[model samples]
Target: MKFDKSELQIFANYCVAAAESMAYTLVRTAHSTFVKETEDFSCALASVDGLTFASPRTFGATWYVGLDYGPVIRSLTDYQPGDVCMTNDPYSGFVATHTPDVVMWKPVFYEGEIICFVAGHIHNTDMGGAVPASLSRTLTEIHQEGIRFPPTRIVDKGELNETLLSWMMCNVRAPEQNIGDMKAQIACLTTGERRVLEIVERFGVDAFKAGIGQLLDYSESQSRAVAKTIPDGRYFFAEYVDEDAVGGKPMRIALTLTVDDGLLQFDFSGSDPQLTSSLNVPTGGHPRHALLLVGLNYVLYSLNPEIFLNAGMLRIATCEMPVGSVLNPVEPAAVGMRSLTCVVVQAAVFGAFAQALPDRMPACPASSVCLLNVKTTDTSGRTIMASIGPVGGGAGGSSAGDGSDASGANMAFLRNTPVEINEAEVPIRIQEYGLVADSGGAGQYRGGLAIVMEFKVFAPNTLVTARNRDRTLFGSWGIKGGRAGRTSLFVRNPRTADQDILGNTDLVACQPGDVIRLEGNGGGGYGAPFRRTVEAVERDVRRGYVSRQEARERYGVVYEDGRVNAAATAALRADMAEGPVEANAFFDYGPNRSAHEAVWTRERYVALCQCLETVSVGWRFFLKHQMFDRLAERIAEGEPIDGVQIVFDLFAELKAQFPALAAQQARIKQVA
Candidate 1:
């Protein structure tokens, strides 16, 4: 190590301060409500090799601490002193996870030598696409998502490329907002460059370079030290997204976390193939990609809060994603809703780690965040596109205490926009916005309650896209003997004669006076509900977080006249304790999942995967959907399902249905 402990600490603080300053500049000067208020952006200082060493710790999204800019950096040619490169293409280097997340980076030079790079990304509200927000689960391909920008120099030698800038703005709905946000990003990078130069001037170029390397090494050591705390073993867990596409069946994401000594490997081999929706995650096969390790980052921070936030933390971990899988989809595959898929990945990682450390881990959080966007017209009839803030649900309960209410948990970095801001910006009326009672799962450490948001739009033909609306069919799973959380609900014209229930539907068309109500899923509980004290249940009822009926039924605690009946509660708990126990009491995946799994057993899924592997990437989702439909029909008729034989039969039928696949039927049959 070139620098001593004290010297390295000072250098690290300086770098962090620089990154934080960049974030401050961006948040204060940004135009969009998503950026200035919701805070869905990040800033970091990376090494010359594009390894993030320092990022804003207390501001913006925490999902990019280990974001690698190396791919985007190497994609471009020789960099001038003031060259600022940009890219939003998911297939190009995987730096920008989706089209809406516009990423930009500027090189910092000292004495004709590159010292470091300043980089960050902001979530644009609109980027011309099929939907208003450029994101929807219904979108089938990347072309439908939005226009993409590959790695190129948006700012060449400190001068803005007017042609490139104009070309980008001409394609989006809100050109003014997008241009303002882009300029704010450039300003942020400029702030970072100045700060980096200051550090080099204060510490000398030699010490600054040496100290940066030592800081990464120190962070790597901290991560390894935390890994040593957990027992070395393989922990496997699987989670599901409510829908594969619009009105589609549930999709599975399997993870096997292998912890050997101080090293960790996330294997996504048994996961489902790429979907025909925008929920795919474009990782580009990078082992330490930010999307794959987003969940791991939260886990490491929860285990040891002192661990440094940088690419070094991911040094102890690597990822194995099957090619053509949801996590590593091929080019042209839609990835607008990758954030939603990443949440499921987080839940799977959390589930896997719970087995390794049951006492310390928390139950599943509300694995969904509904990002609502409104496209309406004013009185003059001009098109107006606005984002109505992200309404996320509660976090799961842990040993420490109850989970947080209305928080995104792992994605808590996405700050919510105030109702005042939303109403003031867009022509909409905010009706009801509060917590839902009895939605949280009951346990010793009770889960957090869900959120309810209802709003009315006055304009007719108002288009609303609620991307990432999930948990409508299956709720968040609980751990130990705790109960599962409640499922989400989305409705139009609620409590009216023309009310309509929409389940996991992302796009909606509304008429005047139509009220849209969206209720997010609650967080799962930890430990046993019977173990929760009577006082906790009574307090929850008094606070309106839990209903009196829920207290009596779920928690086995009786409440009379706004007070707990001690004698009755004790008797009810005793009676509940004597009831039949679940076979695998570790996880409580609600009745919906339990029933679905009963029909589609693990053996059936294994057989289905075997059949899928025999088909091409383009035909996998098509064949999977056909098999699912056939299985549902057979189950409804009470007919026995031969899982293995059914897969082969479906393949043969599909081959005959499509003449293009007819020639490959023989090869498929031979492989099967």
Candidate 2:
């Protein structure tokens, strides 16, 4: 059973290939647009203890790489060879499976003893909730989000658990589709199980385990080496989420990174309290989940192409997230849209690094993935819910150059939905999908530009649910002396008709000819614009990223006849002040705290969420709307605010006033 290094390498490769194959099969077989089109699913092989041994590189969010599967494995301790365990309850070690994601795990046995576990998760089209799709922005508790399944054997001894299956089917709107996807997940896990057994047969289980350990060790060593390269010191940074889905309050995330020797500790002590909304993250026991850790690792490892991705890289890094907070929510906490929290986590990581490596790190980019879901009755009156698009954001400016248009720095792999496919699949017209010019942050290395997407609903009363619409408080921040990117705007009409700003809600009816536009935020710049080269300014003007006036005013460069006026630019720069410009004011969720965070706190946000633990979907929607209205008034008035500074100052003051809050803030701020 003992194997050499070569044998271990081969076994590790086999596991990776098998997991990847499983992910491909799931994507090809699934029916939902979120799965098939967006490709939002993942597959992994884990030890019987629920620790991930191998994961797919192309599927799901990269953050789940470090997730531990022990909770799910322990829940299925009595599972037999033919049994399959399923659960989406955050409290039961499920980190935000929510309703759309149906997670299934199967045990792989070698010689009568369980040796490994195969898990496949997919985002189903519907999971029996208040709406056609199980997206609840304002859910206060888990029950209102959807049916909670604890670690339960969904398939026992090769037989389908009809009772459980029937109950799930009866609850969701798209039972057939959900059932089909579930079968697809089962098939994928079976494939992985078979492949894993083959690896064990060829290399022996002992050698296979050895290889896993070696791979992890190699990764950890490489990560430690990278950490050593970073100056040994404590660096702090912070990031934000504009609001919980219900818009009850803007959430702040702070990190204080302690880098001593080669060890890196990310403390999330100063983060905002747990919300009464569905944006909670269930970290299980791994502090913000393994997936997020994997994402951060990937980004750091990406700096050195030779570094291998394994548990070894994470050995030197640790995260401390407070329980009952947004990053590490407790039982019964509504976690339907935990991805929002994940986005903030990514921002925090970037923020912490920005402090340590200001010259190297880029300004903050527009972070969240905008989800637009359109639902309507087709010709035959059958309800159809299709993902209209996942809008892209601007990239952060780096030392090398300005960010690419519509490129997300952290989420570089994300892609926009094809227009041809959208038109063919649904009754809608794509009016405009192009970059928003002059939106990039002005700097020596300018920030990337966001996109302006406009579409019209062809059918009557088409329900539109657009989430992550505004960046009022959490607009991307600049590093060094760079400028912040423009905030995003969601308007019903542009130029011609009166427009209504959209908020988080169940449905907004749109008639034919009504236009909807989403202008995503640009990323922050890295340095002062006046320091930029004349050639760079000219190129931006030629490419439409900068207008002639903006180039002269922001960059202190003048352009004429599509070419830079070198003499004029030099003169302008000479006249420009040399000292650092004032930092842009902070953005706020609303005009006042009473209109934003105060409303949620007044509603006993934590208590409200606890009560919602057993409520229905409709009730969750009502609660979210109620909270949103109170915050929206503040958001509307807080017009042109600095969200980052507000949260940063508020958390700083809170930590000073209360020791417990300070301890929590310290944990969160440590990674900053």
Best-fitting candidate, scored by TM-score: 1
Model 2 stretches with alpha carbons more than 4 Å out: 1-10, 244-247, 291-295, 503-507, 561-563, 577-580, 583-672
Against the correct fold, how does model 2 do in TM-score?
Answer: 0.83
lDDT values of the candidates?
Answer: 0.88, 0.69
- Candidate 2 lDDT, 1-672, residue by residue in tens: 544666655666788888888888877877666776776676788776666667777665455555566777776567688888888666776643576766778988887888878885676666756655666665677777667688888889888898998999888776777787788777788788888888888777777767777766766777788777778888765566766555455566667889888788888766655667777777754743564564467456656765655445677777887666677766677777777677777777877777676666677777756677788766777766777667757887888788877876555345567898787777778899988787777777888998888998867878777754546455677666667776677777667757787643435678877888887878888777788888888787888888888888888987777667788888889877465444232211213322444444422444444333323323343443444454455466875434334333333443465476445445545655
Q: Which residue ranges in model 1 land beyond 4 Å of their true spot?
A: 642-662, 665-672
The per-residue C-alpha lDDT of model 2 at residue 257 equals 86
C-alpha RMSD values across all candidates? 1.8, 7.3
- Scanning candidate 1 in windows of ten residues, the lowest lDDT window is 660-669
Separately for all candidates shown, the number of backbone clashes (residues 3 or more apart, or on different chains) is 0, 44
| lDDT of each residue in 1-672, candidate 1, tens digit only | 388878787889999999999999999999999899989999999998999999998789989999999999888878899888899999999999899999999989898988889999999999888888999998999999888999999999988999998988889998999999999999999999999999988989998888877888988999899888888999988889988998898899889899999899999987889999999999988998998898889999998898778999999999999789899999889999999999999999999999998998999998788988999998889888878888778889888888899887877468888899989888999999999887787888888888888999999999998989899988888898888888899999998888999988888999898999999889999988988887887788889998888888989988777667889999999998998999999999999989888876766777777777766788888888998897787778998767567667766777678887765755766877
Per-residue lDDT value at 263 in model 2: 86
